[model samples]
Target: MSNIVKKFKVENGKGFKLGDFDPAYSDGFKKIEARKTLKDLIDETFDLQTELYAANKYALLIIFQAMDAAGKDSAIEHTLSGLNPQGCQVYSFKQPSTEDYEHDFLWRHYRSLPERGRIGIHNRSHYENVLVTKVHPDLLLKEHLPGINDVKDIDGKFWDKRYESIRAFEKHLTDNGTVIIKFYLNVSKQEQKLRFLKRIDNPKKNWKFSAADIEERKKWADYMDAYEKAIKETATNDCPWYVIPADKKWFTRIAISSVILDTLKGLKLKYPVLEKEEKDKLDESKKQLEKE
Candidate 1:
């Protein structure tokens, strides 16, 4: 675990520090080997998750946030590939609809929360209440938070209050047996530009490119400030955030898999056992079937 954490540097309010991994020492073959190892670990983790689901002990909520081309989709597709589809659900939040805007910020999000004994993944989640709303103050007018209408320096206070609300909301969920793991895919600006260029150069990927994305890139600094503040304010022990380095795809996959495996490990799940009478009945049934 320590070796995995040392591979990437994670940054937050406490300041930047090396993660439990050092990927630089790993060559291409070594990285591939690590990914293969991660695949096996994830398979075992899914078995545990299935057992945990049957036990109805808890629900797992994973949130993924990242800039365009940060491998958010790929990370999820690969890392969660081993889990049973029935036990997992994925929701991708796009632009808000009129119905979505009609309610409070978390209304759409709460609607998608996982049931007991299931895993829910949010592609881009309710944190957008702070991130996108900060970038475009006009969006707040759509939220309709009471008392926010007349507040002075409303931009700063609005987000501050929202952060507090989010923290409390997540705490309530945690208290109710939901384990939340938030991930922020940190990619450098240079890498983002290269990815954007790739979209232009490739015909199939071009469908994902948008003019609005370019417009958003101009506010990169503003978005970063919003992300930095939101992460610092909302991260808590019960619902901690894992900042993942998105430079190398294999490293990102391994880091995500490790974090998820570690989180699930603490659940201590086991398959349910049959009572003595039930076991005897099963043996008799097997004997009858064998005679047939």
Candidate 2:
């Protein structure tokens, strides 16, 4: 196994434990260098990802969960840019539609799960049930979970149950064939404010800014609580969450890419082999063409 793969072994079947792995632990200018290194790692990983796709032995499902302006879109755009479009699919989870609300919370998510021999990216995944819903309890009106109304501590129990459900869902995916990698872009509040302000001030980025984003910021503490608990409770070794430090965009990108590359390397993927008869036939054809 490669060093990257050794660094990302699954522990206790719940979460991945990176003991001393720090992709962005550096000073001012050095951090920039680290980011570049990370980009290279991601590029290399995509090379392997294409091979894995061709091998058709396993599927990769990447989940990106982060607060607003935490660089989720940028990470996905840049990190996955090199992957073959046909082998890669990206799903951006938005507000649940009426039809989405009619089904269970995991309903929409299940539909987007990656099939065998492909890579699927989820921008904002089903964890919304625990994160966004916890922040805005009103959203729960869309789904009907028993005991939600009856429980006095709705926020606590609500998220706990959701975490349990998410764990089970991921375990099922792992048992079948999908390799699940969950990332939490842990951007500081100060960094988020700066990003949000940039979005507001820049004319080109204005369209990306929404007034409701500020409302969400007001409940930052609640969201943090929800995220902390969800990660702690549900980060099994089978499908673990990587809490990426996003204060530096470059570092965040590299760290993410390294983690991803590590995961793919561990899968021990390779190009498919042809049968001896097929190789002999190809060799014979080459000899016949040469004679012509």
Candidate 3:
């Protein structure tokens, strides 16, 4: 892996701290240069994606988790622009429905998995269960989980179990054919405030602003603690987490594309080779088409 992208990977998240990363990091690449670099990365990823689909042996699941105003949407849009929509599936998870609450937290996400030879993108994925719910433990009541009927039931042991479940779930996916790549867009609180103000200031971006966003922002420290603990618990070699610098949208997109390209390259994907009989059949079909 290139050193440029390797620093962001958290294969073993021991002592991982969000404070250690700089959200404004650009690695000396200016916006103008980053655009071209991102384009090249996307082009290569697109080619590999085609081979991944044709080979039909693996499924890539990309999960994005971040604070509001962290530029997750734009990063995904720019980084994956070259992919064929037919071979990609993107899902954004928000509030749970009545049916969703009835099943385990991973249930809905499990159903959304891409078939072999496709890339599945989760805008805000299962990690939210640990993140938002951890911040607001009262939300757990909605799940109707057995035990106590109050937030007091959610002790440290409960959180440990939840983290264990996440680790095992990801392990099972990797044991099969699913390749999981988790990304945490690490935007600074100061940067988030600037973005919030920009959204409020710009008429075009006003719709993106919400009162609840402010409410959530109030619990920033709690969210950070939750994220830090969750990442430290679940990050592993098979399904590593990439804590990307997201203060600058251009740099965020570039860094994300680099990580994606590296992951796809490691897969060593190639178009399936035809057997002798298949080659003969193709030659015969070619001859018939030519005659026609």
Q: Which one wins on lDDT?
A: 3
lDDT of 1 by residue, 257-284 (tens): 8888877888887777989999999999
> Sorted by TM-score, highest first, which candidate order results?
3, 1, 2
Q: Per-residue lDDT for 153 in model 1?
A: 42
lDDT of 2 by residue, 36-111 (tens): 6766786788789878878988889999998999899999987887767888899999999989988999999999
Backbone steric clashes in candidate 3, count: 0
Worst 10 residues of 1 by lDDT: 18-27
lDDT of 3: 0.92
> Per-residue lDDT tens digits of candidate 3, residues 1-292?
2765688989898888878988888888888788788888899899999999999999999999999999988988888888999999999998999999999999999999989999999999999999999999999999999894999888999998999999999999989999999999999999999999999999999999999999999999999999999889999999999999998899889888888899999999989999999999999999999998
By lDDT rank, best first, the candidates go 3, 1, 2
lDDT of 3 at 194: 96
Ten-residue stretch with the least lDDT total in model 2: 18-27
Better of 2 and 3 by lDDT: 3
Q: Which stretches of candidate 2 lie over 4 Å from their true place?
A: 1-31, 146-158, 288-292
- What's model 3's lDDT at 284? 99
